[model samples]
Target: MTAADFAGTKTALALASSDVTMREAFVETVTAAMDTDPRIAVVTADISAGNFAEARSRHPERVVNVGIREQAMIGVAGGMALTGLRPVAHSYAPFLIERPFEQIKLDLGHQDVGAVLVSIGASYDDPVWGRTHQAPGDVALIDTLPGWTIHVPGHQDEVRALLSTALAGDDRVYLRLSTRRNSRAHSVEGFTAVRTGSKGVVVAVGPMLDSVLAATSTVDVTVLYAATVRPFDHAGLRAAVGSNANVVLVEPYLRGTSAHKVATALADVPHRLLALGVGREEEVRAYGTAEQHDVVHGLDTAGLHHSITHFLG
Candidate 1:
């Protein structure tokens, strides 16, 4: 199977509209969940609170707005979790994960509580806001802690499905939402094989799938799509690699965020891995659009094609 193989599939046409973003889908899915599931509560740091006006009106106690204090937002979610409420924390990526990281590490992780941390402004999604609003290292930072189910949905439909699953469980989950999306959503049961070839294996994380597909369209390599990244699909990846252990991981977060997992998964098998994503070598001083930043980080289609081809060679 290859990129062409996905053409006209039912899943591809289900929600192919580019208008429905992952964040919007999250708000819709979560807000609806609040109606049925009394345990589903939301904690926000003044981000997207207006979008939840109806939910807040219906369930005042469940919907909390912690002003601009990101720390307090996490603290509130932790408190709610302690009281057996499934808290969903929302904010920009930097504020949600980076700003009050200590509170997350201690208030939630140390307290052994569970909450759904939903974030928008993925990496440099709003690069015009500058680096302060960006958080490419969010996933990498959260990886340091244990017992987190990190979800990076590539499409709005996937977001709805992943968020629904997270809400159904009492576990720590980081649902990273973004403006970036693919043309369609995959069923996403672990690392799904989108394309198969004998040259090498490329694992596309979340929104990176479209770019990865285009980059490897001509190359004789297998492409795997991963929406649920944390519980890094070790078995799926190992199976994909089979004998040809040349692997390339294309993540939307910080470069090499899941490189260690890949390394560990293929520990016994001889493999050459190329980890591509937002580069950490230098700070992107210039403020520009997210697409421009993608070029800077070599995450754009051309950049990905160049790097992937070089690695496959």
Candidate 2:
């Protein structure tokens, strides 16, 4: 795919109705699936459980609320998985992945169980809630464990599709949802090409696609959109890089989260990679909107443009 392929489509799609959020879509998709699929179960830690009222009413035994206990939530989900149930756990990013990481590593990874772990409040989605709500290292931490599928959907449509795909299989999957979204959802198989250029390739993960497109609008570089980051698409990236091999990875999570994967992907090919994302050097204690945080972390359009142009040069 190239810029010409999506010319004028994104702007038009952005104007269309977008009242449905990723969380709502998750609830709807999982609830409808529960009506027919008895193996599917939803486990929540007092977050987003109200949205599943109808589903819980119908299948009380399956839809469980473990209250504010995130660790126990994972434990319960793991228990359910042991009993042949497909558990889908939900909570904020920090509470879901960061808080109960030991449980995840032990209860799921150690036990060799499969569950669909869903999270909201991506990074600093609700900045007013402060660092406790922010989890820029979620994906990076999950990477430490083995056999986990990570899906960071850029739009509600993508969310529905990816969630369905995860629910269909009994794999240890992590679906990262965010309030930020792209204007449109691309048919992402693996690092889907949105624009082709010769100077280099700019890999945009999840919600970073739109900003990436804006940043490299005039640059001669290929832009790749990755809704699924884990099991990094080595083949697609290798093909995109061709010979130039100058790559810029623009992720919404911690900086260099996918740098190792990119390095491994292009290990044989000599390449220069510039990893851009939330900074870990220092924590910003100020309360601001997510966009402000983006600017602070050099993830805004301007920040991305500056970094891309400098790296390309």
Kindly report which residue stretches of model 2 are placed more than 4 angstroms away from their true locations once superposed. 1-17
Score each candidate by Cα lDDT: 0.92, 0.94
lDDT of 2 by residue, 75-127 (tens): 99999999999999999999999999999999999999999999999989999
Off by over 4 Å in 1: 1-18
Model 1 C-alpha lDDT per residue in residues 1-313, reported as the tens digit of each score: 6667676565566645457778888888989999999999999888899989989999998999989999999999999999999999999999999999999999999999999999999998898888889999999999999999999999998998999999999999999998989988997679899999999999999999999899888999999999999899999999999999999999998999999999999999999999999887988889978898899888999999999999877
Candidate 1 displacement at residue 98 in angstroms: 0.6
Per-residue lDDT of 110 in model 2: 99
Instruction: Tell me the RMSD of model 2 versus the true structure.
Output: 4.7
Error in Å for residue 50 of model 1: 0.5
Extract clashing residue pairs from model 1.
none
Q: What lDDT does candidate 2 reach at residue 173?
A: 99
